[model samples]
Target: MLSLLLAAAPPALAHHPGADLDKMMGSEEKFFQIIDEPAAPPFELADADGKAVRLSDFSDKIVVLYFIFASCTDLCPIHSEVIADIQRKVNATPMKDRVQFLAVTTDPVRDTSEVLDAYGPAHGLDAGNWMFLTTRPGQPDGTTQKLSEAYNVRFEPLEDGQQMHGAVTHVIDRGGRFAAKFHGLRFDPLNMVLYINGLTNNVRKPAKPEPGWWDRLKVMFL
Candidate 1:
């Protein structure tokens, strides 16, 4: 049975990994907005500990980025939950170290150190690979909100202390390339895991299988 399966398997094609991912996802994934930009919008924000963190800091790793505020009662929590699910799936694999998760708060003034610190663990985000970022001390309150606009997302302030915004998960490849966006909270987490796997897999060229190994195995089984 093993020999039959091996003989029946289709020949592996040598193609660019990024192009393969785009082709596969273009047909199967309706939620992805693929971007061809050379660089993602840059920002420098502070984590819960008040240490400055910039987008460039993660230039060596793939970045899974999103925007949210702790006080948002509608889509923000749902978005965080979705991201947490994706993070869990990513962390389970060897690709964990090659990826980083970042959540930028549009309401930096309200999401203080304490709020940013608790938001992750509360939503099941692993602190080892995830971070919730906000404006550093002395930065304007609307700084992050404007940055969100640059990423093609909007966070409108409402009279009720909640933000009006759409949920978009941005994928930034190493070296700051804006790769794609997974829109809304409904995209399958596994699809994202697979996408990140493609990016990481592209870093190393895979060895080709030995020629005629399938035929040799089939003859042995016969």
Candidate 2:
């Protein structure tokens, strides 16, 4: 519901207007393509164990949500690596307990539980706070893929058995609002971590102080 944008003057910014989050986002704000949409569409999908899991299951934590299939040899692999980089960083901090990384497969038929279970470790993703979720048995095919489309990602099946889809990392704030996104695999992963950190703390870190006259004078003298 709130859009996080950076303006020329911090105080004049709109949205959550002048909150600490605004301060923290600062120049790194460009990395987050903030959304002006409703709460993320809720869905009940199964994890690797076939147990039902919903978006609300992570209600108390910040979620880095993305989509991928194990067989793709293109952007999906790089996308997972990017998320893994951010995941490793988040896990190293206190935010680890407060953050969750979810990878929903677009190719549910080929990405079975065994494949889903092996995908994370193969991609260097830690298991502690991450899970590879998929459609459960008896569910219609492409059920979870449809969920990706709901998030504005398109999935076109190619004749080669691979999907043609754009890469995006969706950031869901603690309460399940589809708060922001990092579009494309080219964006910096650190920015993603900072955005999650801001969500975790509910405040942007204060901006760094500018150099004082005394410090400037000392620099000039030295």
Candidate 3:
């Protein structure tokens, strides 16, 4: 699976008091993994309006990132709908300002600006904090697909004009670290909302323990 592809990189350093916070946030252990060195591979792409958008642009917000093609008949639309549900839930809460959504096209060839622009509204995705990204005309054709691979989502074009791919929802923390991921289409959207809430409020429940010198040494070696 695409998630396995990212295992080559060293895990992100989990924050202190993570175990208590994880439980308090209601984060499902099976669906979400708190990366040790939480950071996402950076990329710059053009939105539907041709504006250059980069990951750094959202450094101050918690990013809900995913990949889809406008014409996809499977997975993409379902994922967007699920995200839309999550968006609505978040927007109803105070954490709305701290959260943002980004969907980059895997099939940039057919997902033109006009197509990309209409996709969100058609799928019930709110425009207030969401943006659909695609490669510009002069950019390489495989640009978005390469970006997907960088996020561990391997998008491959098949002869039938559809794509063979795995689905995952990436949650990038406010500080720009690729913090956590909710794998597959079946994960509850509320689970994501809870996780993002925990991130936004910096929930460090149960307090961080001060590691002893021996504990630090063990962490360095193990």
Candidate 4:
């Protein structure tokens, strides 16, 4: 199934990496939201260990980024599981080093370093190419949540300790271009992988075929 979807992808056209991929995904993958923006919204947050990590730090790698909190009992867990599945598929391929997965916690107040450390392994996320990020020390508790809004996603706090939000998987191309979004956990994981493969290939439009001798002769005569 994965191979078929990849095989069906349009041949790289002359242009940026996401151009052809966006066209193909628009036609075939309903869940994909093509952003194609020049620059993605920049962000600066802390990793589990309190090291400052900025979006610019990953300028050379394709980033698969998403938002989630540790305590949500609803879609967050399912979303992480879906990310885990995608990560597994991505790790099995040569694209592993070319891609990075990031999960940012919306509820940083309760998601301590301990919780962040355990969340990835607990959800089958590979720490080798993935990182769970939280708000930096002294930053407002709602910092990360506010950042989510820059990506057009909202994580609303509720009285029950659960936040209301939608599931969105953001894919940023190398060099910080906002590529696209895979909305919802129901998207076919293979499709996401294939899209990443397209980006990694750095596919460019094939050169136009030169005219044959007969065509040249015809052109000369006409």
Candidate 5:
């Protein structure tokens, strides 16, 4: 069976924490400024089967990175449902062979192998083209805080033991660099396919890390 591997991009890239704070504070667009020069941070986490995977492993394919905990009640579920829809839509496109989806769970304590093994198929995730990952405290790539900070995700474990995070999807080119970013509850994977296809023949580099959803979410809540 064919399978996609998750990878850690590289260090030095470690997103400059809070650097986007100024930009986000200013613009109403609220998307990461699209640095377009930095590569995705390197990472190594385990797949549902307990096998190690890295962002670099998908060097020649498109990777969609998003943060979510399995027990999410609202946006996460909506985001995931959109992802599944995107997957179905992409299967009919020419970009099918070139895409891979990576869902990283911020709540590792609860999103372990057993959790993923259980969550994988029920939610329309195809282990061959899509991989679900959760990093333990000492997984050797980067810390949860580092990854969360890099991606700008602020996840707090609620009393009910559910995860709260900003809803955003990270679209990384095959070269392991940031490309387009899509936000909001609704998703359009075709936009991702078009960008990847256009970028395939050009020089790719790491762009800036996307911002956290907490600030935006707070805005919505208020």
Candidate 6:
């Protein structure tokens, strides 16, 4: 059996390193309101630029995730913009390479790579660690349904071209463990950084892709 490994190198397009955050003391207190939940379901989706991304891809650090439907005229954009601000705060602090941001779209039909690519610079989202991803429709189990099911997020389309669902942000550790859930749009970036720092400095193992058949064969004693 042929075995392969995805060795670590400096990440491209969305990786930033080196930070010093002495400014976030006592900021972790507000996180008391957010509850830690079970890990989100395992799934793989494609980024706007057409590269496959899995939960494992972010096994290197804390991952910040939020769901938004790109075509919505208002709130979705504002939510993503807040995420972009979080990205900026983390990047400018002592937690640069220790975290990443994932902005996933619930609406794929109108959220193609071109569309996502266009949305970034508008909200200062073009930085490294900011990823825009989507699952093309008809991709195995219906894209929206599958992803929503994975996160336990609900989205029912309305007649006037809007969706009815809760809006929240998720923080996941390298092992894909759900760390916290921020229930609303307003939250502190300092709290997030402190949490990410906790995970990065204390993680037991760096995330690795699940061993496939070949990987198992390579380790077999037979």
**Model 5 residue 77 CA deviation in Å:** 1.4
Q: Write the per-residue lDDT of candidate 5 for residues 82-183, one digit (tens) a residue.
A: 787777655544456778888887777767788888776788766668888877446654355468668766777678877666787777776787765666
1-222 in candidate 6: lDDT tens per residue? 111111221131011111211112223344324334556566688887788888788776788888787787767788887777767656654456778888787778767788888777877884577888888545863576557656767877788877777667777877777766665666665455545644565533334323242223222211
Per-model C-alpha RMSD: 7.6, 8.4, 10.8, 8.9, 11.7, 13.6
State residue 153's C-alpha deviation in candidate 1, in Å. 0.6
Writing each residue's lDDT as its tens digit, candidate 2 over 100-140 gives: 99999999989889999999999999989999998877889
Task: Mark the 10 consecutive residues where model 1 has the least summed lDDT.
Answer: 9-18
* Model 1 pairs in collision: none
Tell me the number of clashing residue pairs for each predicted model: 0, 2, 7, 2, 14, 5
**Residue 15: error of model 3 in Å?**
16
Q: What is the lDDT for 6 in model 3?
A: 18
Q: What's model 3's TM-score?
A: 0.81
- Against the true structure, what is each candidate's TM-score? 0.84, 0.81, 0.81, 0.84, 0.69, 0.71
Error of 2 at 219 (Å): 21
lDDT of 1 by residue, 1-222 (tens): 433332342332233233546655565578988895899999998999999999999999999999999988889889999889888777766667989999999988789899999999899999999999989989876899899999989988889888888999999999999988999988877678767766766623444335553234233223
Select the stronger candidate by lDDT from 4 and 5: 4
Off by over 4 Å in 2: 1-29, 36-38, 204-222
lDDT of each: 0.80, 0.75, 0.76, 0.81, 0.62, 0.62
Quote the positional error of residue 220 for candidate 4 in Å. Answer: 46
Question: In model 4, which residue pairs have backbone atoms overlapping below 3 Å?
Answer: 13-205, 14-205
The best candidate in terms of lDDT = 4
What ranges in model 6 sit over 4 Å off? 1-38, 136-141, 203-222
